[model samples]
Each structure stands twice: as structure tokens, then as C-alpha cells.
Target: MKKLFTLTILFFSLVAAAQTEDATSSEINENATFQRWAIDVGAGVHKPTRPFVDGYVSTPDLWQADLGVRYMFTRSFGVGLEFGYNNIQSDADASVTFESDYYRVGLEGIVNLGDFVNLKSASSRFGILGHGGIGVGFLTSNARTLTDATDHHLNFTAGIAPQYRVTKNIAVFTDLTIIGTTRNHYGWDGAVLGTEVRGFEGLMINASVGLTFYLGEGTDPADFAQDPIEAKVDAIAAQMEKMAIENADDDQDGVPNYLDRDNTTESGVRVDSKGRAIDMNKNGIPDDMESSLNARYASQSDVQTAINSANAANQNQIKQLINEGYVNVYFRFNSTKPTTYSLGAINTIVQYMKDHPSATATLTGFADEIGSPEYNKSLSERRAKMVSDVLAAAGIDASRLTQNGDGEDASVDKNSTDARQLVRRVTFKVN
Candidate 1:
């Protein structure tokens, strides 16, 4: 009895140690909630082997019962305290007849084979566990002739259980276990095994079916806990998929499909970041050219006076507007094509060149400070070339148009989208 009490203390101590070790590990996800405690109960048949009276083998009987409480430190590893009872009797046809009652208390280290092998990916409701432990057992004779004779021994037990989850809190399981004992003072039929019989004097095999009841705050049990690494990988995969959807450009415009209002803009047509064609005015011409024409001829009387004065002052004014960045052609983010609102600026430059047949124009392109210096430099060159192409298409001689890339404009705050849009432009220098 004293040994039994001591073993009980050792059992709880080992359980505590296992839990402490698991708590300190970095792999454990502290925020994950699941049931970590469970109660196990079972009953079945037991057969005792060896160390029995000659011709007195134990009979098979439904006389074995066990109960245990388990704590899972992780999904894969745990510890349990179990108590078992068995009623052993010799076969009626045997040479000798006897009946004995057996009892044991053990501490088991449990490994969840299903979780250890990542079987959850294949099946969530099926699982298996392997367990082994050592404990103390007491065997006492129930035979009338040797009622006072008893056996005290140290026992070892190992078992495998296959379980099926029936609900969130309950599961059904079947277990097969072998128990071996040493230091037996008495045999199965009440015969005394003297001190000479020392090592592994007795053995018993048991098969049982039982139910496990999970206890905790959440519906998920620790047995079905997800692997932390697997969970992280799933989260990253979801984020990447979302980014792919958000960045898709079905119209091949500079704008992403998610923000594009017009997904089927014709090729080479100028558009805004929202993928809308940039024709702010109802007039057939783009708004940029309309605005330049409106600014150039705001006063009809002054224009007529300049025309009567040989149009020199009027040409100088137009030249000043083009050179001072007032009539600049603006583009959308990362696009070489001028915006629909800025198309009028190209027409203004074209008109100025046609009016002064001997004049030549320089188109210097610039980008916002968003990308690498080298990429921005390339983008700016493309913007200048695109504007020069439009000018050549409009009957302006290509030889009269010189394109230059000024790279990124660092004057404005890079974080401001409106300010950055103002700088992604092509400016004119008409001679």
C-alpha cells in the first residue's frame, strides 16, 4: 500500500514535468485553444500467463476494467494515470482450481501516432495512440485454502489504441495491451513462487473497448490540434492568392482591374489611373488640347490685336506657356501614353510648330520618385518617345522633335499620389 501511494506521487510528478517542458517550447502556440484533458474508461477480458500452477491456465473472462485521466502536453505527446482491475480464475477442467483478484496503478507516457504522422491531412475523425508505462500491482488469492496468500509485484504495460471520434467531446476506442510483472510471491493457482523466480515472473494480455471524454473550454480537442507550421503556411498561401487577384489587369491598362472602371479601352488610347478614357469635355478633342486652346485664346480682342501686329507677341506668349510648364502633357502612373486630359497640350505644341515652320521642339520627360532611379530613367525616356511619336503622327517632322528623359522629379513628396501625378509629365521647349 505504501508503494502504491509513492508511485501515485511519482506519476503526478512526471505529468507535471512533461507539461512544464511543453510549455517552455517555442513550437507550442499559446494562443491556440483546445481541450487538453480527457477521461478514459474501459472493460474487457484478461488472460494471465506463466508462473501458474502446472495444468492450471487462466480462463478467459470479462473481468478486466480500467479508468484513466490523461493530459496532452501537445497534440503528439501526453501523460496519463490509469488504474485497472482483473479477476483471474483457473479453467474448470484444469488439474488445480483457483481464483484471484488483481489490481494495478500506472503512469503512462502516451504518443498520438495519428498526430505524430500528420494523418489529419487524410482523415480528421480517425486516430491511434501508443502508450507504455510502469506501475505496481497486487495479486491476492480468492481460493478458500490460501485466502491469506498475496502477491506484490512491479508491473510494466504497453498498449495500442485505435479510436474514432463520435462527437466533439466523445470518442470510441479499442485497445490491446500486454502487462508483465516481476517479483511474484504467489502464482495464479495460489502456488508460491520462491525467491529463485526473480525476473518477469508473470504476464497478462487484455483487450478492451471504451470511450474517451474530452474536457475543456473549446469544441476542438488537443488530439486534433493543427500543426503551427502548417497553419502559417496556409495563411501565407491565402495572402499570395489575394494579392494575385488584386493585381490582375484584364484590360492591359496601367491600372489594376480591381480599380479600373473601363476594362476595354482601345489600344494606345490615353486613360487615367482608374482606366477611364481621359476625355473630360464633351468635345471630340481630348481635354488637354481643349484646355490649351481655351487658355491660348481666352480674349478674342487681344488675340485679334496680336494678329494685326504680326502675331509676334502672341507667339512669344504661347512659347512662354509651353516653356514654363503651363502647357505640359501629363501621363498616368507608370504609363507612357499622355492622359486624355493632357492630349490638348500635344495639339498646342503641334499648332505652335506648324505656325512657326522653322521652329524645332524639345520634349523632356520626367517621372515621379516611386521606382528605382534606373527604372524611372527608362520610364521617363519612354514617355518622351511616346509624346514625340504622337507629334510625328500629327504631321510634325520627326527631325524637328528632340526627346530627352530627365528621370525622376524629386521636388515633390513621394508619398503623395496627387503630387506625384503632377510630375509624371512631358514638358515642351519650342524654339
Candidate 2:
């Protein structure tokens, strides 16, 4: 009995060492929450194969019960301690009839097979568990003639349990197990085993139905936890989706957000590779648009006649064009740089300031409703300052020029590109 106990201790020590190694090597989610403790109870039938006296054989009996507690180190592996009881009886027709009571206690290693095996059904409510262990067992005779006879042995147990989850905290399971014993002196019929038939020669099979109750505050049990690798894949997919959105070209201006200095460039408007409007001549209008505007105005004889005239009416007409915003300087979306063709409008202001030295002008800037009102207000101020700088550089006195930002002009349909373009401008008021 001492030797058997020593061997059992050594076996359990080895199992603990192996379990520690497996736990350290496995990948686990440190942040995930799950139930790790459970209680198992079962009732079963057992069949024992044993050494019986002549004409004496025991029949299979449905008198076995088991109770156990388990703790999972991870989703896939765990350990358990269990106690079991079994009753064996001889057939009534046997020449020599006997009865025995068997009891055992074991410490076992458990594996969640559904988690270890890469099955498609692993995510389903059905699962499988495999367990094995070394333990001690005692068998005592129930006959009056052999009241002092008992069999003491070391036991080895192995089993598989197929289970179905009925709820988050409960599951139903069926187990099939084989128990093997060694170094038993007495047989089931209360007879001593022959000296030659000494080592490990006892076997019993058990089939049981049971329930497992999980105990923890978490809603997910360790058996049903998500795979760490699958969770990482999901995280990576979400990051890729965010990257796709950040890199998208919202304005369809042929440039991604990171590289686009001007995000709201008008469609069909010629732009450089960087997505800024192209103004090769350094004028207030884009080169592609300057030609068309020049052609349209060149055929207008009345407009030309007014510009060449020096009379009060022609001067008033030009001033009215500037003040009324017809001759205003246009800008690209979200830019302080005036369009190349609109440079002529600044020259018109400069000429008027020169002709009437006593006159002053106020340059009020306006922006399209593309951005926040506060941001557009600041942008409008910068646009007015830019136009004021141009006039100062063109010899208009700083004292005679007043710059103001009217902020966003929301009168037009904000969804219309043409209307938005028509509003990003700086108009003059001659004082």
C-alpha cells in the first residue's frame, strides 16, 4: 500500500509538470473573461472483469456514481479531481455467489477535444472532452463468511465525455470510461489470487450520464471561448477597413487624402499632380480656364468700350462691376491663392486706387459652405489678407485698403460644384 501510494504521488507529480509546460506554451487571451470552474455529477452502470471462484460470475450492474470538480487553466486544457463508487454482485444462479463494493478517488488531466481539434462544429453547442488519471481503489466483500477480506489496489482511469450545452451555465454529458487496477491480493469472490497471477490484472468499464454546472461571474465558459488567432484576424480586418476609408478620394479629384493639399477641387477643373488647380501663367485664373474667359469677353464690344472710356459713366460702370462682385477675384477651394484669371480683377482695383488717389476700398472675402463655419471664417480672413497683400505689392497704399472676411456664403446649394465655385471669392467695395 505504501509503494502504491508513492507511485500514485509520482504519477500525479509528472502530470502536474506536463500541465505547467502546456499552459506556458499555449497562447491565451489575457484580457478575455470566462468561467473556469465547474462541478460534475454522474450516475452510471459498470461491468467488471475479475477472478471469480469456480462457476461464479458477476453480472453487469447499474450501481455506479461519480462526483468531480474541474478547473481550466486555459480554454483547451484543465485538471480535475473525482470520486466514484461501484457495486458488483454475482448472478443468482452461480454456484458460489458473492457481492463487492468498490470505491476510488483520482486526480486527472482534462483536454477539451473540441478546442484542440480544428472541427467546423467546434463552435456549435456540442463538444467532447478527454480525461485520464492515476488513483487508488478499494474493493470489500459483502459476504458474512469473508467479512475481513478486502482488495486494495492502484487504479488507472481513462474516459471520453460527449456533452451538449443546454445553457450558458449548464451542460448535459455522457461518459465512457475504463478503469484498470494492479497489485490486488483478493478477487471479487473473496478468494486470494494465485502468487503467479500477481501484477495489474483487474479491469472495469463504466458508462454514465451527467450534468456540469459552471460557476463564475463570466457569461462565456472556457469550453466555448473564442480562438485567440481568430480574434486577431478580426482585429486586423477592422484596421484594414479604417485604412481604406482614410485613404479614399472623397472629392474624386484624382488624389488620395494624404497627398491632396486641396481636397475640394472642382471636378473637370484642371489640376496639377498634387491636386491643386493649375495656373501656369501665375495669374488669378487657371490656364485652361483663362483662355475660355478671354475669348468670351473679347467678343463683348460693349464691355470693351466701357473699359476704354475715361468718362464718369464708364468709370462708374467698372466700379459697379467690382463692387457688385461681377469683377471679383475667385479662389480655389480651401486655398488662399487667387485664380490666375482673377489677377486682372486685382489690377482693376489697383488702377481705380491710382486714378482716384483720395478713394479707399474694402476687400471682403467669402468661402463656400464646405467646412465648419469657424474654420471657413478663418479661411475667409486669410483669403482677404492674401488679396490685400497682392494690392499692396501692386502699389496700393496699405492705409487706403481695408480687408474683411464675410465667412461662408450659404445662399447657394452647397451640393452644387458650380455654385460652390461661384462663392469662393473676394469682392471689393470702393469707399
Candidate 3:
């Protein structure tokens, strides 16, 4: 009884300490095993505690067999009922060769400690259980030829079962137990032996191995198992985010400081988008549309004519801007620095302000959809300040430049890179 109490305590301690987060798919399925209804059959040996029932008789050939069915309410706890046959044999030297056939039916409370704890090991397949029960044991002995000799006694049982799961539906387990009961006609004096004999009337060690078959459809294994594909995808996304933070650049032809280096070997060579040297006239922007109208065009009168025609068109756009009272300048994503493409628009505003000294321009900055509102608001404010600083540097009065930031308040096309670029910009209204 003390051993049983000690074993029970140890089992609960193991369960409480084994909890962790790394349970594998197979471990998950193994846990699912407990929700099943099972049938088991076993046969093994039992060693009696009493040295002599009626007299000094050397007991031998001790054996036991069992058949049972169990239902698990949860992975941790269950209940079972079983019928058992046991025989206690005596040595040939003993008078009358004492033998007792004990048959009993019992109800048990079972606890599966392993699954209750949920260990983290991926390869763990071992399961441990602790159980106890009570029932009636009918004792029939060779000496029980008389009606008085045949008696029934209360049986108390406690056991530990260690099992290895081979599959979802089947497992092999060994049950080692201590069963206790009493024999009615005890000594040569014909008196029943009392509790002073080994803890609970009498005791025996019963050990058996059996095949357990899960009878019904259990819980699906996939329900709690982690999805490998989804895990991989999440890992890849995290890696890409880290790379973005670290600024991964295979070719150094991108942006801001380190990413701004040209891919070409030549130190001073200006390269186009493909990293080839920029052609003076054959660059993507046609010579006629260029703001400075390249000096190379100065050698050709036809090119000069084309440049003059473009300048006239620029003048007409300027007139339209003046009529409308302002112009808009766009920036790249998350940048406060103005681009050469937008500086022309800024210069036009500068020129218009110079022409009418009473005019004041309000610069409102905006940001793309990629960042948080608070961060975008701060970024937008910086953008507006950058434009205002430029206007001050360009000889415009500080008093005439008023700046504002709208953050991500306005909607713009965000379906593509080029579209989102349009949102990161500053607009102007002259009054």
C-alpha cells in the first residue's frame, strides 16, 4: 500500500513537470489514442504473499489471466471493468497439495500520465498509466471440498501499465499489479488470517502483457498538428523582412548612400537603369523633351528647332500653372529629398512667387500606403519641411512658405509600384 501511494505521487509529478510547446505530429496522434474505446486480453504470472494458507505449504505455479474493456473520457482519465482468473498453487511436498482458483470482476479508474503532461520530444512513443480498483474475489481451494471452505472476499487492486504505441489503433502493454484479498479458512486452526499479514488481508504480485485494440473511430490526428507548409511560408516571409531590414543588394545600383553605388566598373561613368553608360542623346528621355536640352543638340540646327518647340510647350504648361495658382511636386517612397524630376516643378513655383511678391504658397505633404499612420504623419511633416527648406534656399521668403502634412489621409492607386509612388508627394496652393 505504501508502494502504491509512492508510485501514484511519482506519476502525477512526472505529468506536471513534462509540459512543453514542441509536441510533434506523431505525439499529437498518440495523444489522440486515449479518446478510443478499447478491448484487451492478457495472461501472466501472479506471486502470492501468504507463505501458508492452512499450514506451511510452499506455493508454486502461480498464474493469472484477464479480459477487459475500457472507455476514455479524455486523454488523461478513463474507466474500465474486467474479469480475471487466478490460481495459487502449492508445492508437492505440502499436505493435500493446496490449490486455490480465484475468480473476480472489478471496476478501475485509470490515468494516462504521459499524454497528460505532453512532453516535447518528437520521437517519444512510450505511455505510462496508473490504475486502482475494487471487486469481489471468490476463493475455491482443493481443501474447499466442503461448503464452508468456499468463500467470497473483497479484492483491492492497484497497478502500473507501461505501453508502447505501435500505431493509432494498436499498442502492446505490460500491467504489473498488487492484488489483495483474504482466504476464509486460514491456518491449521481454521481461523481467518487478519490484516497484520502484508497490509490489506493478503497480497499477490500479478504481471501480464497484452494487445490492446482501439474499437471505435477516435479523434482525427490532423486537427491539432502543425502545418509544415504554412510554417515554411511564415519562415520565408520573416527572412524576407529581415533582408529588407538589412538592405540586401546584389548589385549596388538602388538608392540612399550604400545602395546608390553604380554597378559599372568605371568610377565616374553615369549608368542608365540597366547599368550601361548613359548615351547623351539616346537615353530613354528624348532630347526634345529634356529640361536643359542637352548641349550636344547645340551642334545640330534641327535638334535646336525641336528644343525650341519643346520650350514653347513648357511655357504653355507654365501659363496653365500660373492660371491655376500652383503646381504639385512628387517624391519617391518614404523620402523627404526631392528628385530632379520634381525640382523643375518646385522652380516653377519659386518663379511664380517671385513674379507676385504678395503670393504665399502652402506645401502639404503626403505618404504612401506602406507605413503606419503616426509614422506616415511624421514622415509627411518632414517632407513638407524639406520642401519649405528648399524654397527658402531658393531665395523665397521664409514668411511666404507654409507647410502641412496630410499623412495617409488621401486615397491613391496602390495596386502597383508605380501607382503607390504617386502617393508619396507634396502638393501646393498659392494664395
Pick by TM-score: which candidate is best? 1
> 2 or 3: which has the higher TM-score?
2
Q: List the residue pairs that clash in candidate 3.
A: none
C-alpha root-mean-square deviation, each candidate: 13.3, 11.6, 16.9
User: Which of 2 and 3 is ahead in lDDT?
Assistant: 2
Q: Cα lDDT of model 1 overall? A: 0.77
lDDT of 2 by residue, 1-431 (tens): 34443544554564476567556755654224668898999998888876555425556676899999988776677789999999777778877777778889988877777876854244557788878788898888776244345567788787899888899889999999888788777676666666524555777889999999998756577777666667578789999998888788877878877778878767766787787878776654555555544543331234335555634555777777667665677888889998765766777788889998999999999999989999999999999999999999999899999999999999778987666777888988996
lDDT tens readout by residue for model 3, 216-297: 6644221112234444676899998876855643334343233444342122334555444354765333223333223212
Angstrom error at residue 335, model 2: 30
Candidate 1, residue 129: CA error in Å?
1.4
Candidate 3 off by > 4 Å:
1-34, 55-62, 116-122, 182-199, 219-431
lDDT of candidates 1 onward, in order: 0.77, 0.76, 0.61
Candidate 3 local lDDT, residue 404:
88
lDDT of 2 at 7: 47
Tens digit per residue, CA lDDT, model 1, 85-164: 99888777877677788889988877778976788898889889877788898888777344345577788777899988
Clash tally, candidates in order:
3, 8, 0
Candidate 1 vs candidate 3: the lDDT winner is 1
Which regions of candidate 1 fall more than 4 Å away from where they truly are? 1-24, 27-33, 58-60, 145-150, 194-196, 250-252, 257-270, 282-431
How well does each candidate superpose onto the true structure, as a TM-score? 0.57, 0.53, 0.44
